[model samples]
Target chain A: MANTGSNQVPTADVASVASSPRPYLPGDLAMWFFILAELTVFAIFIIGFAVTRQLYPDMFQQGQTYLHPVAGGINTIALISSSCLVALSLNAIKHSRQNYAAALLGGALLTASVYLAVKSWEYNELIQQGFGLSTNTYFTLYFFITAFHFMHVILGMIILGSMAFKTTKGAYQGKSLSGFESGACYWHMVDLVWIIIFPLLYVIN
Target chain B: MKPFGKMEYCWWTLIGITLFNTFLGEQFSSSALVSILVALTVMFKGLMIIDHFMELRHAHRYLRLMMRAYLIFFPSLIIVTTFL
Candidate 1:
């Protein structure tokens, strides 16, 4: 394999590629922009939640009382731990340690499963208590935000799981860190969103 | 070419810190101060994810700049809209 001085292709080729206006690579600038747009959408929802909370602080507080902070906190730990595993997996890929990467990815996947299980338990408890999405505006927003995050977590898991499979198959043998890098970036975004959501919804009361 | 050294230590340290903060945040709801502290802890966790996990520390300068901008602008926009 040719050792390019930097990870990026040479400047001359970059200029030519830029001048042609070719589409960015998958998981490139456009993808990042798409992620940013998604982030903006979630931010708007959060702002809406904040405004509603400001308007009816007591009801929002009451809604918080119904939430299981211990469970929520446990979920936070789970996600954080999963994020760490994903990060370690990427590091393993970088070092060409395929087996280590596979192991880390397995750990991450397990953590995701645990996250879903805990979330299911929490949802079950809330549903039993008649505090579901239809319960109130706060519950509505709560479910919406968390459900959106859950979808991302599932997607991240799929992506990481696929990467893990490929790693075991020697797909990333040399000079291809993009797959792991992209997965890490995506998983970090997943973890970051949870960090914001946990504080805004659970701890701030 | 592992992006980070001390992988196991870093991973466990971050997990420990997050769990500690989460427990403290949930158990004691005496003041907003605790909430802020918890948020800061989460923020630190985020920094670790970006720097070590995402290998942003090893990323190109332009990419790093873009990520930093996104992190700042998105949250700031939300906070401002909340007040408005």
Candidate 2:
């Protein structure tokens, strides 16, 4: 309710505006649907990982031995850091802080790159040790799940890169932020999935 | 700390939770209790992400419900399958 001079502005006039709930679902409708679809795929892979581990405890246990839990922890921190950057960047955009948002998004991209580097190094080490997809059921599912997620991280990095570029141009300043929100949401999904993946794969054992 | 908004607080708590969960998980390993704890931790983290990070707290009811369901169901499924 904008203040008026006399201060007796009719209550009925602004009642709806003041009373109505702003149930804002951030991001594009299409993006939410896409998030749901992507989550469904990841869910299936994760469930498969669980079910297969049940069937082959020994294999899964051995596979866990070959994994680098320390690396997993590092990647977890990296992803979480990136997610935080994405969220903070969007918040910056909301405040019309373009350069700050761009810097944060760039930080996000860099953190995600850290995750990619660690993951790729882990993959290389595993391959050098003869742990390919065909190695066993455990390695098969391991490669299947992690590789799928790895690709998503790469895609997320691309999205963040683009978002950072646009942020620098002041494109989102004082504008409808659905696009900015969507990219941030996607990066967060990648992070959310990792929050589950790291504990399940490396910590829970 | 003085100027932090809700999102900043959420971010800080999330970092704390992640590190804490990692520590607890390592300490307990694969015990039945730790397994269940892991499941619950995942749920908590998912809720924080979907509701807070994703800002779905004020979104339509079903969207939050659906995402919540996914986070809950999978961890529960893992717990069930672990004993099978």
Candidate 3:
């Protein structure tokens, strides 16, 4: 590996900082905008949930009786763990620790799997109990919001998987890390959404 | 205290809060005070993610504040709508 400078910071990184000056934003500017847009859409949906719950407080209360708080708790831990791993993975990659970063990405994927598994278990249980989206207003919103988030989780895993592949090949070493940072940042957005959703759906009830 | 030598400390705090929220959820049904507390917790968790996990504390002022708006807005909305 070519040594860029005494700070051990790569030339690309030094260039990034010099170009931006102090108070660096860590990922692609476009990615940040994308995250904001996504957040807006979800905000609308959650507000809908709140309004509908207000309209039919009894129905929502009935719905909450079936939710498993323990499962939600486990899923929260899983997603937060995955987010931390992704952040640490980016930190490792920034330092050019490619293999370690790749491993961290793998760990992130594994933890994310825990979230999916717990969610799937919840969905299956809800379905087996004869609850469907059409069951009532509450179930409909529940399925819609969570299914949308579930799809995002799958997409995030794909992005992380691609990053892990490229990391193992040293694609980001001594090079611009914008692509990797963008992907990592996206994964964190998923966790961010869940951080609210868990309480909104399961805990608030 | 090099409290944040790594992401370790933030991660642990998040885990603790998740468990706490779970406890709150199970221990009490939906009430005004509980709802407000839960919404506040959402804001706290949002700040933790934005500052630490997303590394936005050292970020540009405008961009960081944009993210902050989302994290803060929704929870506040939840609080307001709770009273509605």
Candidate 4:
């Protein structure tokens, strides 16, 4: 049979559909899935800790007494400030303000350094008090969670520093801002995680 | 793009709020309540980051729907498993 107009969908409509912006590209979706999986893993750890705390309220309270809230509070501010700097850097890049972008990255690096310094001080204090990873269940959880977060902070600083270097070298000038964008997203996620951990681990008791 | 500065201001405001909450949390004696409040603050911050910083606010409707689906569904599952 001869092809009829009634049987044919419009090519323009098909083209429009194909050209429409998808909710996520393959890479973005994959990255989001990876983050979700990582979040679930941390959730499991949180739930386990909650259950244990329920079982040993007194011990957990005692554990809380040993934590320094001042240090924890400082670290919270540091992470939040770092997130702000990264975000500002992303905005500056979008605006083609290379100098400002570099400045923001420098700010982020400085904040990360402060965070690490305070963290080391806290760790040293804890160690001096004999509260290592092997100390007890509470200490184990504390050390593991904070250590994992510290590693992320270090990673985020490296990413920010690299982006700064690229900006100075005139990279990311015309391309889509996806690289800096994703790095900022990941850094915010790191900050978000620490926000939860701050209260749960230190201030809660 | 037009409201980029506004978005930045909002995010900075959120950071300020979170810092305030952090200070308040340090003063609270009840761990559970403090933890709950802190969680809520962080959730708000997360929403701001996703909506503004990630540029998801200007995304297509279907994409927003999908995001809402993920946000609601996964947390629900976790809560169900934890409670029941």
Candidate 5:
């Protein structure tokens, strides 16, 4: 169906799909399904968090003041950086650099690890002050929402970690980078969710 | 394979905008305007990741449409529930 005929017959389909900016998507289609489904769940949770915050504005405001915005902000930057590394890893694999892609994935994993460490510190402080999940409306939503995203970050890291191992194993050569793309897509979703969470819970007091 | 592609550029932009948003939110803590600005910043950052880092800029028409729809839908939820 591709009449342009790039002359590279073996990779013609992929090249055609890549060249056409429409009617085709990147990576495995099933992964997109999962990404959309996960996003829908988080969207509902976020809206719920907002409605509850509206109901108890004073509680949310007070909770926000007690929490450390700097930690959240730093985690935001860390996740953003990790997502960037994931994107770079995808690019590296696209250019047929398996080792380079693995290295980039390792970097992404390290950045995410840092985010979790800082988050654990924040959780420790909150728990020390007796702000458990049952503390109040504000702390309840805060812990639940952030914890949900926190788990996703760990899952993203696991996916990235496996991708790194496979890349190092030479599983994804020039045209077989779908696995890496799928992992990167999920990582970016984690980052996107936190982008909203940061402003809503931490900044918008 | 450029050393610094558009994705890197988009990442840097996300960082700068996020820091600016934090500064504005802190500076205008009492003003009603900061919430709107924060919502907008959140939306913008989501869009940047969807379109650039996720490489959906060249995705299928419906996929691109749906992702952008969520970007607007979710962030607008935040803004709406905040003010109304």
Candidate 6:
């Protein structure tokens, strides 16, 4: 573990301060602030979706019926499984198991790839069936929400890709885990948003 | 602190619950009972990810509270506006 002390502090003071419990936020506080802001915007979007659904019940229901719930469900599992691998990767790094951590991060990247591929397939099908964003209010909202989320997934994959590389280099060990945790936090937020999105756009009628 | 052993278990549990929620939604699409159940399931899944996957279980009190609020507020809004 890296010493949780400043060079100016004496050795005895450093030891005592390290032993004392202090509340700490995971990752960078700035990252947490970013996450909170991101979530707030998503919440607004979801609320707007709900309100629109209320106004156009028949159109929303009809649009939802055309969607493939099974595809959405499969993607849900993929993202959640990827999230598990990300969390497990952090666990491995915490134990200084660099190879294991790299392997787990690799697994997470694969699962994320699966999610993107499945999403692409779904989008292809939608377009092939002539369901463009201008199809209707429901399709507009659906395409917008999902495509926006799709971008986030891609961004997350990029972050995980770098983290995996760093893990193989043994860069994130012990007190150096905040970067890894921050990446995981962002990935989990993607999964969290999808958890609600899947049901809202796919399952609910 | 079994050091990550429990995480895989939590992962599987999340998968099982999510699958179960999908099953409920499919079986009872028009049932008010299922709507409430589905909303609750979404909230539960979000909480699990925030607490376990995100490690908010060890986070500061304000952070934990903020997450809790997000988990509750959004799902409740969805249920009220859509189901009711």
List the TM values for chain B, per candidate.
0.65, 0.78, 0.87, 0.57, 0.81, 0.80
Off by over 4 Å in 1: A1-27, B1-6, B69-84
List, residue by residue over A67-155, the lDDT tens digit for candidate 5: 77778888999999999998888767766777898999999999999999999999999998888999898888888899999999999
Best by lDDT: 3
- Give stretches of model 2 more than 4 Å off: A1-22, B24-29
Q: What's the TM-score of every candidate structure?
A: 0.81, 0.88, 0.91, 0.78, 0.91, 0.90
Off by over 4 Å in 6: A1-20, B1-3
| Separate DockQ for every predicted complex | 0.37, 0.52, 0.64, 0.34, 0.67, 0.58
lDDT of 4 by residue, A78-124 (tens): 87778777766766766677788888889988988898999999999
Error in Å for residue A102 of model 4: 1.8
Model 5 segments more than 4 A misplaced: A1-18
Model 6 DockQ reads: 0.58
Alpha carbon lDDT at A69, candidate 4: 78
Expressed as tens digits, the lDDT of each residue in A71-173 for candidate 2 is: 8877888888888889878767765678988999999999999999999999999999988989999888888888989999999999999999988997776
Fnat of all models, as shown: 0.42, 0.53, 0.84, 0.27, 0.69, 0.61
lDDT of 3 at B27: 89
Quote the positional error of residue A13 for candidate 4 in Å. Answer: 28
Q: lDDT (0-100) at residue A37 of candidate 5? A: 94
Clashing pairs in 2: none
- The lDDT values for all models are 0.69, 0.78, 0.84, 0.66, 0.80, 0.79
Q: Is candidate 1 or candidate 3 better by DockQ?
A: 3
Of candidates 6 and 1, the better by lDDT: 6
Better of 4 and 5 by DockQ: 5
- Root-mean-square deviation per candidate: 5.9, 6.3, 4.2, 8.1, 3.6, 4.5
Cand. 3 Cα-lDDT:
0.84
A175: Cα error in model 1, Å = 4.2
